[model samples]
Target chain A: MTVSSDTSMIHAVGLRKSFGSKSGETVEAVCGIDVDVRRGESFGFLGPNGAGKSSTMRMIAAVSPISGGSLRILGMDPATQGPQIRARIGVCPQEDTLDTELNVRDNLYIYGRYFGLPRAEVRSRTDELLEFVQLTEKAKAKVEDLSGGMKRRLTIARSLINKPDLLLLDEPTTGLDPQARHVVWDRLFRLKQQGVTLVLTTHYMDEAEQLCDRLVVMDKGVIAAEGSPLELIRAYSTREVVELRFGIGEHEEIAPKVEDLAERVEVLPDRLLLYSSDGEETLAKVHERGLDPIASLVRRSTLEDVFLRLTGRTLVD
Target chain B: MSSTADDGSGALPGTLIRATWVTDYWLTVYKRTWKGTVISSFVTPLLYIVAMGVLLGGFIKGDPAKLEGATSYLSFVAPGMVAAQAMTTVFGEVTYPVMGMIKWHRTYFGMIATPLGIPEVILAHLGFVLFRVATVCAVFLLVMTPFGVFESLGGVVIAFFAQLLIGMAFAVPIYAFTVGLKDESAFALVFRLGMIPMFLFSGAFFPVSNLDAPMEAFAKVTPLWHGVDLTRMLTVGNIDGPMVLVHVVYLSALVVLGWFWAVRRLTRRLTD
Candidate 1:
């Protein structure tokens, strides 16, 4: 079949994926979600572990089969044109799928060859990707010698050897330190600026805010909310949050006292969160009501706060 | 970006091109580590010929009628030793290496993420297995020349191809078993249950006809005996055309069937 003439890099309608568990039952990992990732836009799937983020990414990478519904990657049906779609897309999987047998440079070279690129072209692109990922110096080293962050960069570099139209990163910086994470984010930002349509999965709200132009916050195999970070915050959360830490075991009791002081009151085990348009005003009213908190802080609402509003749970454990 | 079109029909030539790239990767790996396998590939074959044919044959005085239709025990054992060496080397190639690709190193998973299909991956691996068998058996033939193992060079040449065919027969099925493994210990079970039994009773050192009827019949069922007897037949300059045909067809059938089974298991594991 001819490639579909679509403007979007990825278009999915009611995408679904399921696995047969050991108990002889089918467990749905991604239950019918529509997704449209347009050309040159950075989109993300923001979710905690077990949210089906990796499963969806695998299907889009054309490495996993779809159990139900439809998925078109880069305007070609993955079921029929998996190799064709994968040829045009770069994928940095959640797991480190790098070849341990080959040294750093050969990983990129072999991956490019898998897409049927010429040897000289793969060699030149290998050098270019090593430079891009700041791994030129380590090109001759074994993959085992590289640290976790360095391995992640090499995987990213290997994915791009084909110069794909679309780039998919699953948990790109999940296990990296803050400084190393920023380095990855910076490189990704550069790729986005170069007009590579990027799709990534991350549970880190800051990462979503830093890299994604738009995203879907997924939970329990479904999309809970979808928007830009600011738009999600503005729609689901107040302008600010006042975090109040009270004396031992007083949070639940004091939560009722501040019920009328904000748009919403959430009582955690250690603290009470007052969601309000004006955090200082909410704190002042809490004091006027004789509710003495041990400590307090006013902060601008973030995607975490938005996630809390939509899912009634925190983003990370 | 370059055009992302499927190669016409995505069969034969397209599969071959991609499979060759995969073979190239293995070739690169082999270039690095082949030096380390010199013991098994070259030196080990030499030791086996000396120990089994020359050293051990010095003792046996089989019935003058025939030592499995050979005048000397060395002549009978030489061909079997070569065939058995091919089996051992191919077993090494397809077992842990296959498991490592599927599970530990995740190299196959990485390839699947790219445009390489599972069929290409399988074909490329078995191609490398073929190469491994060729190199080991070639070294074996060179080692055997001084021992006067072959009646003629042309006959030895025919025996060499027979060795290759038998090597594939062993490799394809063993690879099928390796792909379905999760734990490394399962390999030990295969060694104890399948490899060792077949290696010992495949008439490499003695005739299987000496065994009881049940055991002899069982030896005939294993592919290695066909390899050993056929290689021996050609090596001794004896023409049993019908029996040779039977051996070729049987080993070839195993290679084809085991290949499909391997492809199916790999596709299921990697794709799902």
Candidate 2:
């Protein structure tokens, strides 16, 4: 990605982050990498834990120092102008660092006050944000009294106190239940519609596919593949994957017989996956080979398939 | 930021104003929890004044030198109580709250996520501790006025400032130590080993002259002793300029040193 000051929200070249472990060894969290996020775009970092997504997010948020390489956020160098950069960007951290000392409303108000927002502005913005996150009824409630999903909403509202241009959410709905996740996703979707630039990291393929306009699949502190969810699935995996589960311990034995039946065959412990553009043709070929399968199913390729194809590992360990 | 930031252009430039904002956060939070602290800062110390200074002073009849240049034991012990209260209040504030900010709740991480730096967070939290000490000392002075413990109004005024310094002497350095802490376990040892001994033997209730050489020397090196000595001298109108200078310089240096140390520790802990 070329560095452009005007349209670029985030531009990085060979960015790296290294941490000193307790055992006195240098642990490279993020190896040298390049990333660029344009204005109003939703970018995702799809990787498992220890994949350096959080380190990259921290460096981009201007909270963590860049260990090496040059990076810019909103066209400002984070090393030299961290405060000025932070003043403009909203950060929803992985853990909800909500002010347990204050009520839901005061949490938003005090955060705005930290930005030197005027009293009237903070008050009105606090009200507006509470309503936006659907926490107006719980405005006077203590932070500890709120549910897990409510705390996350309050954190998102607090981050938006400054009306930031770029919003950095680190696994926004990570610990949330399915219903809570949908609530957060809906709120985030609205934020995207309002044209707030979002940078998020998640191992959830559905989350990345639903939220991201473009994404990078990271593995072992480096980006393995970078593209849209559809593009990644198209590039790295077949159009569809056919799952055929045989009798007990028949997958490995049946894999060799079905090797020429489809474009590719993956033998797992309980099932054999045949990858091809046409899953029905592959299944028909399997039957023509006199392969009797107890169960069979077909599904369109997803980002998980792309990840499994690229890294040969599951997204969640 | 564009429309409402006109008033944010404060008298000073940008650096100190942000610190005040962080301090403002403490003040706002303190508003909710201030009621719980009254007994410790005000009621308990005042109770000690009634129990030890007034009740015990009536029994020391034969000794004039034992009063330590004061007309009564109440007057002698009153200023000492003020300074000791500062140390207790500030030490209490800095220990668990500092640990809570750093480790338990990670409130400091929340602050640093904004434009507020680590230095501002440390300074503002310490400022809030000093504010608590000032209020506790001031209220102590106000209520103790009825007892006729203060020898001079001017002396009480100076002692008030001395208590602030003493409070910070404990607060800033302890803050430096606690801001990097991982848990509240070390605080039990600090209270048992550091706070309890200093409160008792820092010439607060009794004169250090009555203490042995090693014990008195230990008391002299503590910030609480300097606070008690300086505050006592000012409250009794027995001003010792050189000794007061020693106390002032010592506490002030500790305050600055502690502040810088806390900043360094917080910087290391919060940043990469």
Best by DockQ, which number? Answer: 1
Evaluate model 1: give its TM-score.
0.96
How well does candidate 2 match the true structure, expressed as C-alpha RMSD?
Answer: 2.8
What DockQ would candidate 2 receive versus the native complex? Answer: 0.45
Model 2: per-residue Cα lDDT over B1-272, one tens digit each: 22223232223355577777775588787888999988776788678888878899777553557665778888888888888888888878988878887777878888887777776677688778878888898999997999998888898888788888888888888988987777778999999999999889888888888899998898889888888888888888777789988989999999899878987888878887
lDDT (Cα, tens digit) per residue for candidate 1, span A80-102: 77777777888898789988767
What is the DockQ (computed on Cα atoms) for candidate 1?
0.59
The candidates' interface RMSDs, in order, read: 2.2, 4.0
Q: Alpha-carbon error at B47 in model 1, in Å?
A: 1.0
Off by over 4 Å in 1: A1-3, A247-250, B4-9, B64-66
Judged by lDDT, which candidate is best? 1
Q: Is the docking of candidate 2 incorrect, acceptable, medium or high quality?
A: acceptable
